[model samples]
Target: MIQIKDLHKSYKMGSNSLHVLKGINFNVEEGELVSIMGSSGSGKSTLLNILGMLDEADEGSYTLDGVPIKNLNERVAAKYRNKFLGFIFQSFNLINYKSALDNVALPLYYQKMPRKERMDRAFHYLEKVGLAEWSHHLPSELSGGQKQRVAIARALASDPKVLLADEPTGALDSKTSHEVMELIQGINDEGKTILIVTHEPDIAQMTKRIVNLKDGIIIDDHKVEQIRASQYV
Candidate 1:
C-alpha cells in the first residue's frame, strides 16, 4: 500500500544541517499492521509527516496506493492527504469547544460532504468506537481514553487508505492503552493498513511487524507472532 526508497531529509540549524532521515527504505503492504520504533532523535515522526504529506523529503521516493507523493502543489497535496491518509496523535488534537460528534464530522465538513450525510457517518464511527452515548460531550468532558476514542473515530471517519498513528498510546495509562490497542487490532482485522510509531515494547508486540529505526535508517524489520491486545484489555 505504501513504498519508500532512499528517503532522505535534513533541516538547517543556523550554520549546520541536521540530517534526520538518511537512506531509509521500506514497504508496507495492504492490510499490514506495522510499528516503527525509535528513540529520541530518531526520524519516526519525520517519516510519518512525510507519509502524511504534511512535509516533504529532500531526496527519494514515496508512493502511496500507486501514486507518487512528491513535488505536488499545496492544493494537490492537500487533496491527496485528505483522500488517502488518516492520522492519530498522542495529544488527541481535538477542538475543545466542539462536541465529540462535531469533531468527528469536521473532516467530512472539509470534504464538503452534505451535512446530514457527514453527521450520520460521523455518528456511525463514534458508535463504532463505543462513544455513541458520549457523542454530545466535549473533549474536556471526557476521560483520556474517551478522548482518544473520539480521535480514533475522527480519523476513521475519513475512511482513508492508510492510518498513521504517532505515539498513539503515549499519554494513556496501561489499561487504557491496551483497550485502545484492542480497538486498533479489530480495525486491522478488517483490512485497514496501519502504521503505529511507538517506543514501548509491549505495544510494538501487538503489531504483526516491527520496524526499528536508529539515527535515520531502518536497522531491523521483521514480522512477529501477533499478540492480541484483547488479552490484556
Candidate 2:
C-alpha cells in the first residue's frame, strides 16, 4: 500500500546541511501493522513526516496506494493527505474548548460532510474506541488514555486508508499505554494499514513488524510473533 525507494532528506543549518534520512528503502503492505523504531536523531520522525506527506523528501521516490508523491502542488497534496491519511500524535492535538464528540467530528466537518452524517460517523468511531460515554467530556476532564482514545476516534472518523501514529503511547502510564495499544491492535485486525513510530520496545513488539532505523537508514526489518497488547491491558 505504501512504497519508498532510495529516500533521502536533509535540512540546511546556515552553511551546513544536516542529513536526516539516507538511502532509505521501505514498503508497507495493505492491512499490515508496522512500527518504525529508532533512537534520537535516527530519522524516524523524518521518515514519518515524509510518509504522512507533511514534508517532502529531498530525493527518491514515494508512492502511496500507487500515486507518485513527488512535486505535487500544495492543494493537490492536501487533497491526497486528507483522502488517504489519518494521524495520531502523542500530544492528543485536540482543541481545549471542544468536547470529545466535537473533536472527533472536526475532520469530517473539514471534508464538508453534512452535519448529521459527520456526527453519526464521529459517534460511531467514538464507540469503536470505547469512548461513546465520554463524548461530552472535555480533554481536560478525561484521563490520558481517554484523550488518546478520543484522538484515535478522530483519526478514524475520516475513514482514511492509512493510520500513522507518532509516539502513540509515549505519555501514558504502562497500563494506559497497553490499553491504547490494545485499541490500536484491534483497529489493525479490521484491516486498517497502520504505522507506528515509537522508541519503546514493548510498544514496537505490539506491532506485527518492526523496522529499526539507525544513522538515517533501516538497519533491520522483520516480522515477529505478535504480542497482543490485551495481555498487559
Candidate 3:
C-alpha cells in the first residue's frame, strides 16, 4: 500500500558529498510482511525514516494509500502518520517513569479518544503481548523483553495500517529476540502490513520476504516460502 520511485537522499560531509540512496524503487503491499536487510551504512534505516514520514528524500515520489505524501504540510503529514503508521525502534523509547499502560495509551491522546477507551484498548494489546499484569509497572521495573512488549503495545494502540520497525530486536538477548519476532509475526498474520529493517539474517527470515540492499540500491529480494520449499527436496 506504499510506493516509492527514484528515491534519493544525500548528505554533505566536511569535504565530500555522501549519497546514501540512489534511484530506489519499491512497493510494499497490504497484508504483507517485508524485511530490508543490509550491513551498516546501507541506508536501511534511512529508508524506513522516509517511509515513516520522519524524514524526506531529496527527490522522489512517495504516495501512501493512493495519496501523494511528498508535499503534504507538516501538520497534515503528522496527522496522517499518526493515523496510518506505527513505529518500533531498537531503543525501547519508553518514558522511564510512566507505567506500561500509560505508555501504550500515549498515542491515543493524539486521537483525542476518551481516556477510558484508550486505556481499554491499551490493556487489550498489552495483555495480547503477555503484559497484562505488568500494566502498572514502570519501565525500570520490567525486563528488556517486557519493555519491548510495552513498546509494541504502544505501537498497536494506534491501530495503524502499517508498522515499521528498525532493528527491533537489536538490544534484546537471543531468546527475547525470538519472542519479540513471534509477536511481530502474529501481528502480520492478522493482516497488518509490516516492514522491518534488520541486519540479522534470522530476523529477516521471519518475514514473508527479504530484500537485501547495498550502496543504497536493492540487490536481492527473496520469498521465504520459496526458499524454504526448495530446501525440502
Candidate 4:
C-alpha cells in the first residue's frame, strides 16, 4: 500500500524554477495494478522517482506501507528501498557481461543472501518469468522481450512489496510489448502491487486503474474493466 498527499516537486534552472509535480495526491492499495499515464513533461517520471524514493519531493507527504518517506538519511532510504521497492526500467538496465541468472541474482547478493539461496531464488524467479532456459544468456544474446523478462525476474528476485515500472513496454514491438504486459498482469494477479508509468493508452488499459496526469497534476483517476494483455499477445 502507498499514499501521497499534496505532493509538490520542482527543479531549479539557473534563475528560473521548473515545477514538475503540483498538488499531486493518490493512494494505491495492496495488490492493485495501477498505471500513471502522461505525456512527456507531464510529471509522471518525477512522480515515479518520488514514489520509488529515488528522489525527494520538495513538498507534501509520501508514505510507503506505514512509514513516512521524508527527510530520511541516504542509508535509511536505501534500506527502505531495498526492503520495499522493485524497479523495472525501459532500458532493461542489465549488465552487459552478466548472464541472465547472474543478473537476477545480483540484488540478492547485495542483500548478502547466501550464495546457494541467492542462486535458488534467482532460478525460481527466472522460471517464474519463463526464462529459466535462458539463464546462461547475456543481455546481448536475448531478444528484447527476453531481456525484459530477465529484468522482471531480477526485480522480483528480491521479493519487494511493490514493483515500480517505467515505460516497461516502450522499447518492444507490439507483440513483444503485449507479451511483457501479459507477464506483468500475471504477476499482479498473484497479489503484487504494481505501479507502471507509461504514456501508451493501450499499455495503461492493461492495468486495473489509470491515473492521467497533465500540467503536473492528476487530471483523471479511475478504475476500468481490465483488458487482458494475453488477448493482444
Candidate 5:
C-alpha cells in the first residue's frame, strides 16, 4: 500500500546541512503489520512524519497506494492525509476538553459529514476499541490504556487504509502496552496496514516484521513468526 524509494530529507542549519533521512527505501503491503526501530536521531520519527505527510521529504519518491505525493502542495497533502492516513502520536494528541467520541469525530468534520453519520461512525469505532461505555468521558478522565484506546479509535474512525503510529506504547506500563499491541495486531488482522515506530525490541517483536533504522537509513529487516493469537505467552 505504500512505497518509498531513495527518500532524502535534510535541513539547513546555518552553514551545515543536517540530514534526517538518507535515501531510505521501503515498501509496506496491504494488511501488513510493520515496525521501525531506532535510537534517538536515527530518523524513524522523521520517516514516520514523512510517511504521514506531516513533514515533507526534501528529495526522492513517495507513492501511496499509487498516487505520487512527492510534490503535493500543503493543502492537497492535508486533504490526502485526512482521507487516507491515520496517525497516532507518542503524546496521544487528544483534545483535553473533548469527549472521546468527539475527539474521534473531529477528523470527519472537514468532510462535512452529516452529524448523525459522523456520530455513528465515531461511536462504532469507540466500541471497537472497547471504549463504548466511556465515549462521553474526557481524556483526563481516562487511564493510560483507555486514552490510547481512544487514540486508536480516533485513528480508525476514518476507516484509513494505513495507520501510522509513533511510539504508541511509550506511555503505558508493560501489561497495558501488551493490550494496546493486541489491539493494533487485531487491526492488522482485520486488514488495516499498520506501521509503528518503537524503540523497544520486545514491542517490535510483536509485529509481523521489524526494520531497524540507523543514521537515517534502514539497517536491518527481518520477518518474525506471525502472531497466532493476541497473547505473546
Candidate 6:
C-alpha cells in the first residue's frame, strides 16, 4: 500500500547541509502493522514526514496507494493527505477549546461535508473509540489516556487508508500505554494499515514487524511474533 525507494532528505544549516535520510528503502503492504524504531537523530521522523506527505524527499520516490507522492502542489497534496493518510501524534494535538466531538469532526469539516453528516460520522467514530460518553468534554477535562483515545477517534473519523503514528504511547504511563496499544491493535485487526514510530521495544513488539533505523538508513527489518497488547492491559 506504501512504497519508498532510495529516499534521501537533507536540511541546510548555516553553511553546511545535514543529511537526514540516505538511500532509505522500504515497502509496507496493506494491513500490515509495523513500527519504525530509532534513536533521536536516526532520521525516523524525517522518514515519517515524507511518508505522510508533510515533507518531500530530495531524491528517490514514494508512492501511496499507487500515486507518486512527489511534486504535489499544496492543494493537491492536502487533498491526497485527507484521502489517504491519518496521523496520530504523541502530543495529542487537540485544540483546547474544541470538545471531543467537534475535534473529531474537524477533518470532515475541511472535506466540506454537510453539517449533519459530519456530526453523525464524528459521533460514530467517537463511539467506536469508546469515548461516546465523553464526547462533550474538552481536552483539559480528560485524563491522558482519554485524550489520546479522543485523538485516535479523530484520526479514524476520516477513514484514511493508513495511520501514521509518532510515539503514540510516549506520554502515557505503562498501563495506560498498554491500553492505548490494545486499542491500536484492535484497529489493526480490522485491517487498517498502520506504521508506528517509537523507541520503546515493548511498543515495537506489539506490532507485527519492526524496521530499525540508524544514521538515516535501515539497519534491520523483519517480522516478529505479534504480542497482543491486551495481555498487558
Alpha-carbon TM-score of each model against the true structure: 0.99, 0.98, 0.94, 0.98, 0.96, 0.99
Across 1-233, the per-residue lDDT of candidate 6 in tens digits comes to 99999999999998999999999999999999999999999999999999989899999999999999999999999999999999999999999999999999999999999999999999999999899999999999999999999999989999999999999999999999999999999999999999999999999999999999999999999999999998988
Report the C-alpha lDDT of model 2 over 1-233, residue by residue, as the tens digit: 99999999999999999999999999999999999999999999999999988899999999999999999888888889889999999999999999999999998988999999999999999999998899999999999999999999999999999999999999999999999999999999999999999999999999999999998999999998999999986
Query: After TM-score superposition, what is the CA distance of residue 201 in candidate 3 from its true location, in Å?
Result: 0.3
Better of 1 and 3 by TM-score: 1
Report the C-alpha lDDT of model 1 over 10-55, residue by residue, as the tens digit: 9999999999999999999999999999998889989989999989
Distance (Å) between predicted and true CA of 226, model 2? 0.7
Model 6, which residues run further than 4 Å from truth?
none
Whole-model lDDT, candidate 5? Answer: 0.90
Total backbone clashes of model 4?
Answer: 0
Model 1 clash pairs are: none
RMSD of each: 0.7, 0.7, 3.2, 0.7, 1.3, 0.6
Q: Could you tell me the TM-score of candidate 6? A: 0.99
lDDT per model vs. reference:
0.96, 0.95, 0.89, 0.95, 0.90, 0.96
Task: List, residue by residue over 1-233, the lDDT tens digit for candidate 4.
Answer: 89999999999999999999999999999999999998999999999999988899999999999989999888998889889999999999999999999999999998999999999999999999998899999999999999999999999999999999999999999999999999999999999999999989999999999999998999999998999998986
**Candidate 1 wrongly placed segments (more than 4 Å):** none
Model 5 misplaced regions, further than 4 Å: 227-229
Q: In model 6, what lDDT does residue 71 have?
A: 96
